[model samples]
Target chain A: MMDRMAVTTTTRVAELHELLARHETSPAAGNVPVHPELVELFPRGLRTGAVYSLHGSMSAALALLAGPSAAGSWCAVVGVPDLGIEAAADWGVWLDRIALIPRVPAGEWTSVVAALVEVSALVVAAPPEHISPGEVSRLLARLRTSGSTLVVLGNWPRAVATLTGQVTRWDGLYDGHGHLRGGSLRLEVTERQRTRYADLELPVRP
Target chain B: MISAAPIRVLLLWCPGWPVLAARLVQGIAADRALALTDRGVVVACSPAAQAEGVAVGLRVRQAQHRCPDLVVLPHDVAAETRAFEPVLRAIEEKIPDVHVVRPGLAAVKARGAGRFYGSEEAAAHALLTHLQRFTADELRLPVDLRMAVADGLFTAEHAAYSSSARQPLVVVPTGRSRDFLAGLPVSVACDRRLANLLQRMGIRTLGDLAKLPRAQVNSRFGAPGLRAHQLASGEDSPILRPRVVPPELGLHVAFDPPAAQIEQIVLRCEPAAEGFVQLLTRSALICTEIRVTVQLEPDALFERLWRHPWQFGKTEVLDRIRWQLEDLATEAVTTDDETLGASVLSVQVLPESVDNAEHHAQGLWGDRPDEKVEHALTTLQHRLGHESVLTSTVAGGRLLHERRVLRPWGDALPTLRERRLEQPWPGTVPGPSPATVFSSASQVQVLSADGAPITVDERGTVNERPTWLRTHEGQRRIEQWAGPWPIRQRWWRKVKQLNRFQLVDNHLTAWLLLSDGAVWFTEARYD
Candidate 1:
């Protein structure tokens, strides 16, 4: 029997490219101009305007949204607004093109979140003071429909818990002297959800 | 034969965190987990525990009945996450990129970090030692966490969970990731739905899951299943995201405050201007115009612009701004004016141009010459305020209203007429009526004193019915008259609506005008 999981991913990647091809207006050949950060997370660029909540280090997000191409790409970080904005600016992201939506009380934020999803490529939203299974599913659907990626910044969404693909674990270790060993650390990213692919660990040396 | 790279994972699951802590208290590296509660320590005695013959949800009495020697302790979520940060920080100080997949689990790239710390196995040990230190500090507890470096993230996660003190890190060879996951359970592969789906398909092991048709699995499981498929086959490498540089011209200077007098302010700007000029010199660029901000205590912050001067010189630039500050003091009768006492916190310089050859040629010679033209404008704007020093340029338009553009000393963009006019602009209702407008515009109602309807015919004529109009500022009666000017615009626009109105006046010197649901107040007399 053919490996079901491996075949699904290959076909999915092809289907996505076909959809993106339908939206291309410019005559640029080969690959479309995509934000590099999205490329790292999802090798293919995410859809233009949607909500994605990436729950990880500030540096991780910074690595993606730091260039002229990012300006036209709008993102709103919900919980850590100041840190997110400052880091975005540090990464060459323009302030004029970006909008910062403040953090709201628990459980009340989702009502207004759908509004922002229309114009932004990525939105960082936490479950309002409380998170519901419906809200998580709805958020995922909204992101998928809008061609956006959602990064739930804290715990993984309990509703749609099945994980697929590689999950990278990050860690920072201090040297004997304690000075930051710049760009010198360890990284462990493993394949958690897949069909044809074997579960593997990706290690970064420098 | 080339060997493949391995994924480095830090697994921290030891059942209940407290049970693990209790084990450490007994001078053993605890593998059992526990939690602290309001009443006392509570061990997470559940099915997974009871499967091993431990009791489910009971007091210490009942739990001990099931397994008297069972490891027990308190629960603490905060301690786990907190104690976890230092271990991460310690690893992060050495790694280029690190991610905490869960409170206890971490994913690190092994190739780079392993080389820095030596071999892959050695790097794993160093991390374990560091984490042991962190865990030891938190509960004075001994911990036996494990590390697994494989080709993919899933295998590493599984390996970490399965590893014991006897065999910590299972370093799988490159291209062997697929083989390693063959025997792993599919339950560990996903959350609930896919896990159930895989179980339904009778595919419990990763190898069994990989055997099914991919297209069918993807269509059935949706996005999450598609991802699961990719991982089982050992695809999707985690690429590290790097930072990009920002482009902006910023200059900042902090000063000791409470400095009074224009002379003192002028003196303060000298160094700032000099510093800005020095920066421009180093970059081989000349700033055409500069914006100066004056910090006024107890009230407001004042901002102005300086025009681009022809000559470029450091001395000239600083001297001109100094002169502008000094002139402001003398221009006012009393030096105690609101504008006089403000001290400048810092000055910013925008490099408006780098096209000048003289600047580049001078830079080639290692000489940082200052710009005299920018210096002159800086002073002029400082003394007269930015708005006072304006430049005018002709703009293309059929109407006199749109004929010209005005700019302050340092502001860069051209003046625009329409609100967000870049796209299909909204044109105002048309009429060739007034030569000038001033004061305010108000709305009015036309009527006869006896309440009989006063009619105004088309073509700007009023019948002898004693018609009246009202001013918006107040509901005063009409006192004067002007011809009715009817106009239409956007005839080409679809679904067009009428926006026509007549000009009338209310009682008193105040004049009122009405059009298209809006009223305006204009002055009666022309200069």
Candidate 2:
């Protein structure tokens, strides 16, 4: 009876260890992959059917997109003409799989965004200036039904989460001689009126 | 005894067909001097060009020098084949079993046609008359058509080449091809190396090569030489594989009263589109390229060629038609051509190229996981335009804006040349590249400590240290900055000289600044 109890206990312990490892590694249901350096802010990874409003850092937004894009999911950018492809590539986003919708007339902006939401696994759009609440709701409903994520470049009302990062100190620059190599960023994440802070490095990888 | 008989072939040859096709299709005047060049060498020249001493084997520059009015055109193989299709159709009316040797050359089994028309000469005459009438009626060209009947295709082709314009039909008597080919040079076998070798061996003519022992010749030169020797001896073997003519699968839809709206035409043509795809599927084929011709009322015809990366489906076909119709509508509005209020009378969809269905067949597990994504993107494209939905790739360029190449959905992705990308561009801004690259750089004022505008001198030295950056947004203090890397490019043509700088302001935003020796501009932003 003692031997049997010991075997059972060891087996139970192994099972519990495996479950813990999987919980830590695997993305939760309705969540997509996020960069390892960004996991502190997005603990459950980027949630599906949710809007993430990103401000102050386009590189951070591209970094967020790089995760799912590198994982071979189709991502799109709408109305952000200046979104640098080279930067997106440097941030680890697969340049070929990403679609860019640079310009859309104000009248057809929401419709175009909704159409992209239906197709892409994730869409990054800069919401136009004159978008109404109704249009936003309609787009959110489409996003919910399609189970795709949206990352807005600027302000988005009632977003599920908001990310703001500021460059604290740039590395490899001494005012004149050397180039701007990388930098440090003070990243802040706010969800449900609760805020979390993380200190990260730009270009998480060398 | 029957094995000793050589197969009879009737060959149709059109000299200078490339120039003739260019004239017929491109509407180049026949009286004008025209030469078709392939790889900088004149392959064919029209008679008018020949009158000015231009000929095949002449360099393009030499030909142009000889004939100052020479119109040089690159040889277009596809256009040549397209122009030859109607001629093949016209000949197929007389002989069903015709084999195309190339665009300008074709052959048919002379025995059947000869027996049907009572004699080889009668059959040749009959074909010549029919072709004459067909060319005059349809192409409206005085096509120099030559026909010859002889034992085997090689002898028949040589006979056709030898025939003059006056006597366009040359019929070599049966069993006499040996004598007919004896005087011809050994180069007629179309093997340049072997001909040269044979000439070096003092065998200059086909009769000289034929005089050698067959077994010795085979032992000397192997398979190709043996084949050439057989051609020289006029023992031509039967080897023509006649083309199995494909059935016409082009779809044609006609509106009785002419459809006004683009949507209405697309709606009415939905059944035809389905039928076209289904017909291709039934034949185990898929069309990759299609030529769409839209005929509008009041005698206006608009045609366009569309290509698909994959096989065209019904939905894709309908989308292409709708897009083309929308383009037509817009063009009508802009050009104010009589087509402004004209209705679409008919639309024809013809497959320009096709592939076997097995190449595109789905696997058991299914192919293309992004079919739904493609469908949705195509829907958006229809709502907006083809250029609105784009996929991008990083191309090799020093300029940030030039590095990104965007293509529409379903368009071929630009291939990245690794060697070019691996180039050491001296003055490009070092990565990590800025995230947002402005298409047009906005002007900025980089001010020194005393607020005077900073500048770079001709000796590549900064006039002052920049402390504040002023822009349309607002003025901000430059917390960190980098040097002005000079870029001098294209000095020979249009000189582009600029100095680039990287600056980080107090707001934690990074800016890529450029100056053309005078004013500063923000080229990109790391926002």
Candidate 1, residues A1-206, lDDT tens digits: the string is 12343345345545655654564333212222234433444454433333333332344444334432253544444444223232243345544333333344455456445544544455545455467878766755665555444434545443222222222321121211111112211112222343222222212111
TM-score of chain B of 2: 0.73
Superposing all C-alpha atoms, what RMSD in Å does each candidate have to the true structure?
28.9, 11.7
The 0-to-1 C-alpha lDDT of every candidate, in the order given, reads: 0.46, 0.82
Model 1 TM-score, 2 decimals: 0.32
Q: Is the docking of candidate 1 incorrect, acceptable, medium or high quality?
A: incorrect
Looking only at chain A, give the TM-score of model 1 against the true structure.
0.55
- The sequence of per-residue lDDT tens digits that candidate 1 reaches over residues B1-527 is 11133344333333344444334334443333222332432345433346555543466655555665555555555565655665566556555456666556667777776788778788878877776676678546555677787665666776676777777666766677678788887876678777887888788887887777779878988877766766777654454232111135434444566555555655666676677665554443456665555554555555556554332455555644554555544554664653454555544444445343333332321221122323433444454454543333334432222332344544443535432334442333222112122213233455566644444444334444334544344444443344333333322223123233323233112221333322222322110
- Per-residue error for B29 in candidate 2, Å, reads 7.2
Candidate 1: residue B43 Cα off by (Å): 24
TM-score of chain B of each: 0.38, 0.73
Scanning candidate 2 chain B in windows of ten residues, the lowest lDDT window is B361-370
Error of 2 at B468 (Å): 2.6
**Model 2: share of real contacts kept:** 0.65
- The reply for model 2, stretches above 4 Å from the true place, is A1-55, A90-92, A102-119, A127-206, B1-9, B23-33, B46-53, B69-71, B114-369, B380-388, B394-399, B407-432, B439-441, B454-465, B479-509, B514-520
True contacts kept of each: 0.00, 0.65
